[model samples]
Target: MQVNKRPYGYEEQTMFAIMAQILLIGFGLVNTGWTQTDFFPEETQLKTAFTNTPIEVCGRVVDQNGFPIENCIVCLTCGVATSTRADGTFILSNAIRSNQLLTVTALGFYPEIIPVELYLPTNRLAVELPPIILWPSNGNVIRFLFGGDTAFARRMLDPLERAARNEFPIENPDALISVSNPLPGTLRVVSYVKPFFLYVDYPIINFESVVTLDPSTPHWEKDYVYFTLPGSLPAIKTLNIDYVGLGNNHVYDYLESG
Candidate 1:
């Protein structure tokens, strides 16, 4: 029996075919930029794992009340989002900047973003966060008007009907609002609050001026500041100033007295 050795080119042709197929596959992988998890698990973990960051956190989710909210999703920076246990307990460990915000989002609850340092400190501290109250998002979302930085210097407003109005799509809004330093004046500044209140659900203004006879001054920077009288404050309710916003700028106007 003679051994057959007739194919000289066949071996080289087979090897070349195999090499061509491999080259095609390599080019495809290069274009797509896919990592091989089987070969290098550590590198893949480094790229995709949010848990690898150096902050450890645990917290409970609750309503406005003290009751625990089950199955709420708590999320943090670096994509470290997770679901809470039945007891509203959640744990996450990853390193994100203290200045970054931690977001806790859930269905039927308003998404809230608090500073990451509030929960997980940038100093790599482990913290058990206080139960966060999830505000309801699914109720009747009434759109109300809110204005900022309004300082009415004893000025009466023109009527909404006569004062060339912009055609707003004011449907059934919950309220109309003007905020920060609009005090009720001697000439019926509250007149403005009533018509808007009659048209909508409620009309609200933030009375920044103190209804007081006290002449003590916190206005060290300027002598031009004035406070409304106590008698005038009754006009605040009489004209239907439905709500008041006591923000920092208003409260700081008279310092502790304010």
Candidate 2:
């Protein structure tokens, strides 16, 4: 057999070419103003995935007379539960953008449910909700239900688009596509536990994506993976979420503009 040798710089040249091609593609993506809708035609009209940045939720719990309620349990229905400090303040960290419910309860205070809509604010990852007021009450029974993150983007977009087109088996399919109703695909995604949410006094979740309507580019400089959801998605309201946590590292993937 004859011995054969490769070109001295063949591998280096090939690697250089690949890098150049990658740079060109990245340049095009940055300059062409390609949004999530462009790559997925089914999402053109849906306007989903605004930002998948993480954020934090913090707030103070107080009584009607503005007294700090210590040792109060402040928690999202899905997890990240915490007890308020002596100052009646609590911080829930590592929360993502989404709609959720917050359940607050103490020994002598009546439990209260607060709806949270997590979104990316300008240059901020910590969202401080307004002070929650709790009323004094005698012995009372309450119920709560918790769930984890609910995100509809990337791989989930196609199914959502199909559900929007009435391609799924659901009652009142039209409602799934309605802007004012729960998204069909989102409902389908949670159908197994949908009944649980309905029966609970407070249903909460950790929304893992920034919700926005602004058509903006991804934070290519800082993140390899980023996602966002349209603010108009009706599923947020229809799900009857009580709290949403917006604390995460990727919250600024779209810059302050998003």
Candidate 3:
């Protein structure tokens, strides 16, 4: 038999080509299987499982002052709901995964809605949220009445003395003009303006007086004198005064005793 000579290294090259083809075919098969397994039914099932999983969410609701707002209705957009305790804390046991909204509602306060995104395989099933603050609601329009330099001392005492002696006429006096009364002559002095205070949502005053009964002497250094008796507290309450500004120069007229 005659032996035919082939090119140098031709057999080795042929073996390598065949092996490469086999590897390519095996890799294609593996890649196709992996793609289908990862992107099809299995992936869908995993996402569905994650979405259906329940989580616990806890948070607190408070006012602008950081005071707990009890009885606030805390709920998820998916219908899971709970009420805040006296301490303003609430918990949801079955909060669903994925993107969701957490809503907080309370009487006389603006409602708050927060977006939450929960994912799968978390180390902890419970989520603690930051404190939520709710602002007090002012209806369509808020009205405020402000007064200036409200003091019942010095010259103001003249009217009270006159009223006590029946020398000054007061209309619709709420009380007797006597020292024993809570506001004494204050009601008479404020009689004309009292109606305005009652009609507004907030009544504010520049309480230029130091409200105390320590019998402290006035600061003679200042030309103007301003001080009020503690008995005037009832007048403030009666006017529904929401704020009082004591930033004037005369606030320390009676020294620390004031």
Candidate 4:
């Protein structure tokens, strides 16, 4: 180092100032490319460290033996993660499109990443190495027919009451055939009185509560009369008339029960 010899006054001070300025300029060149504005331009700040387009991923994990791996943790770089269940399945929701790297890791297995395709949904994914497999969920539709209340009727109308009572058979033949029950089985015919047994001889001209005595040809008398149904119910019809019910409730004593 050499000392500058100058008068110890303004001249010496000026010499020291000039040397100091030269040293500062040399140091600036070593540290940075000296510029008046700044050593570096203004740094660009990242407004957001994330993306807007969200991604949805679903994947299945399995062991090396080709069996499902349950309760395995799955993670991604975009702060989205989930775990596999007993069926070795996991779903990653609300992930950014930029974060296509899906990290799948299972216990006692190697961690792996996969790229998300542009048009493919992560619903069904298969991993064949270190062994991992995926499958689609099973969906099915079902149909059921609902009608008739048998148990309710059976419970309300007890067995004892059902036995003692007589129900009018389904009056609507179409209803009986279509709704009640198919009627291709054996038919039950019932009638209160047979054709020959109906009391058709009670005449209004004869004395009430007494039969007039005709000693000559009693059975040949034509004075007796009674009304019968005009013709008959269609003979082709199968009637199921119970005699027990007919014998008990007889308000018309004029009509005899067969």
Candidate 5:
């Protein structure tokens, strides 16, 4: 290593130094031996030697039926918060050995908190937490209807119309929803969704655009994307969509406008 470095020019040495500094700065924002960041809290206040320890605090979240819960928010009282992936898996690497509480919350289910002790060693340890089950909080059991990605689906109108007529059940639903689409056009195809949106208690959708007028530059992203006309949101307001989660890849499609 010394022999190779001896032949390197000043530019190469300078680049390595900059990279090293960047790495330290990156880690500093999360956790370090001296200070703790809000998003990555440590339990102990001890000033230990600087460690490059790769600790793992991993866990899964599920419903009472043992089915996995997606998009659950898991937060530790120590400061860090992580969301479970589609399969209900999450890992908190900056976890310090602490005797504190870990809170788990989801949209429809009741929130739960569990006691935790996250300890770190010289070597890496995969500390897996227990499966957190979220039961329904409200006594009134609700039936929810869900639909998939509607970005390019101009054919979604018929089903949405059925859902609105209650012909899908003729029975009123507790909640009916669609996800991850921004209303850009006149929406002649899915105007049926408006009625279902107005009827349900939790009128929710995953909005994936800046939801504005005055068109912005096309996103350089190499994936499927869409932006809603600001005028289109009036349709949303008419439907009374109560909640939105920016959990899709294209939420950043408009860059700063996003």
Candidate 6:
């Protein structure tokens, strides 16, 4: 066999390539701070897993100072009542058996009672009652709203399947109930894989049925519609418009598909 040795230039080139890859990886890790946390347990036990239950009971609470009270005690049948946080909110759910009386009590404010109905899951109640009128003057009603995961992109929203893309794609819980509460226009969003919470004061809904004449198009079976901007924009001679709010859930989906 003849003795042979590779050129020093090739060896130096290979070493330099390996060092460059190592430096790039280190720079990436340093620039981008990412952490991994366990959201779901590895071993899901039937006892620990929550069986899907329809959320029925809902409500809110307010103090004498007219401030939303959070984490006050909400109870049924002298059972364990959930505490309200500083927002003066609580909920009693139908996960427990029905035909129970919901009682709410706090330190300085008077306690209120709510009767549980047989149709508990879909029913809404008001547990927080206003202080009884000692004098005869009407009061202003405070308004609040709640819901989440609503696709509120101000554009033509396409189907979700057209949204998810591979590589370099941009991407984007508890309660108790009260009866006769003051939550007008409040919406509760059901959580799926991506959980979200929303509380809107004035929800102006402009939802329309998706219109299509063809059956073989990309967005064939999905219901979608377009939203118009409030006012017309004056044309500029040397400017182009960029969809600034496209980072939202719906627009991001459309962009991914496009």
Quote each prediction's TM-score.
Answer: 0.34, 0.38, 0.38, 0.27, 0.34, 0.25
RMSD to the true structure for each prediction, in A, is: 21.5, 18.7, 27.4, 41.2, 20.2, 19.6
Off by over 4 Å in 4: 1-53, 118-258
lDDT of 1 at 217: 45
Ranking of all predicted structures according to lDDT, beginning with the best and ending with the worst: 3, 2, 5, 1, 4, 6
Better of 3 and 4 by TM-score: 3
- Candidate 3, residue 7: the lDDT equals 65
TM-score between model 1 and native = 0.34
- What overall lDDT, based on C-alpha atoms, would model 2 receive against the true structure? 0.64
* Top-down TM-score ranking: 2, 3, 5, 1, 4, 6
**Cα-based lDDT for every prediction:** 0.54, 0.64, 0.72, 0.38, 0.57, 0.37
Model 6 error, position 119 (Å): 3.6
**Candidate 4, 1-258: lDDT as tens digits:** 999886589988999988888898877744545557633343212212223335566767876456888877777666778888888877777765552445666554544455554232333232222335432222232212221110112112132332211231222433212113322311211121122112112111111111111112212232332111111222113332112112222122123320
Residue 54 in candidate 3, Cα distance off native in Å: 80
* Comparing 1 and 3 on TM-score, the stronger one: 3
| C-alpha RMSD in Å of predicted model 3 compared with the true structure | 27.4
The most accurate candidate by lDDT is 3
Best candidate per TM-score, number? 2
Model 3: residue 197 alpha-carbon error in angstroms: 1.1
lDDT of 6 by residue, 185-238 (tens): 012211111111121123222122211222122343335422222111111101
- Per-model clash counts, in order, read 5, 28, 0, 1, 2, 28
Better of 1 and 6 by lDDT: 1
